[model samples]
Target: MRLVSLLVVLLLSPLGRAAEQTYDVIVYGSTSGGVAAAVQASRMGKSTVLIEPGRHLGGLSSGGLGATDIGNKA
Candidate 1:
């Protein structure tokens, strides 16, 4: 859900300033998905740039909420 929202925002963002620079792919937010997108673009021989507004990456998981279901499932 979060990824979808991010994508929408990026898609709607203004392109005037962006038009000055050229890139095969521009991934907003440094979330895991963003990283993957940039990586995939690079693998395809395209110039890719990953932009992160925050000072860190990995989204909430890297923001100290990496806890998982380690308890018994039963």
Candidate 2:
């Protein structure tokens, strides 16, 4: 009985192992913040993946803004 059960379990088990992608961090979006985060993660020696909805990066800056110029601090 034990042998039969063991054999059944073994046979019922998945024959192929699922391939898993491991990453320390996953950044969704290639915007400035996303790029910065990914770069920081890479600098820290952690794996990172940056995904962008658009074809370009740098978000608004890449959209012909040239420079962000978020004002200056007093």
Candidate 3:
């Protein structure tokens, strides 16, 4: 079983990773939800790869848009 798991990781690692890069989860957007989800997944003990084509994190939070128009906040 250990060997099988190792083999699986070896085989899938390349396809799952970028050139010389590896990540269990590749998040393309830096949205609030995406960051939260990635954090949650990491807490679950899984390798994660977060990638945001955009040049910033926190979708709107880092974008200087605080005080959401919504009626609730987490």
Candidate 4:
């Protein structure tokens, strides 16, 4: 287990480096909020980095959610 963890760390180190290369905002989540945040940040002239544990882009969106679960739509 330790070796596997170390291998994972080593493999993901590059990604970490890339994320730190230069960014005004680093959003960590694959949810809709995360993508929206990134876009808004970029539009504001801020380099944005969207980091998510999952490989897919949007969490529930790409996972098969026809509609978002924002109970309280402001």
lDDT of each: 0.84, 0.85, 0.82, 0.85
Alpha-carbon lDDT of model 2: 0.85
For candidate 3, the TM-score is 0.54
> Which of 1 and 3 is ahead in TM-score?
1
Model 1's C-alpha root-mean-square deviation from the true structure amounts to 11.2
Which window of 10 residues has the lowest lDDT sum in candidate 4? Answer: 14-23
Best by TM-score: 1
| TM-score of candidate 2 on Cα atoms, chains taken together | 0.58
Query: Candidate 1, residues 2-74: lDDT per residue as tens digits?
Result: 9999888888889523667789899999888888888999999999999999999888768766566456487
Residue 49's lDDT in candidate 3: 74
Q: How many residue pairs clash in each candidate?
A: 0, 0, 1, 0
TM-scores for the candidates: 0.60, 0.58, 0.54, 0.58
RMSD of each: 11.2, 10.9, 12.5, 7.4
Cα error, candidate 1, residue 18 (Å): 11
> Candidate 3 overall Cα lDDT vs. reference?
0.82
Candidates 1 and 4, the one with greater lDDT: 4
User: Runs in model 1 with CA error above 4 Å?
Assistant: 1-20, 68-74
Sequence-dependent TM-score of model 1: 0.60
Models sorted by TM-score, best on top: 1, 2, 4, 3
Question: What residue runs in model 3 are displaced by over 4 Å at the alpha carbon?
Answer: 1-18, 66-74
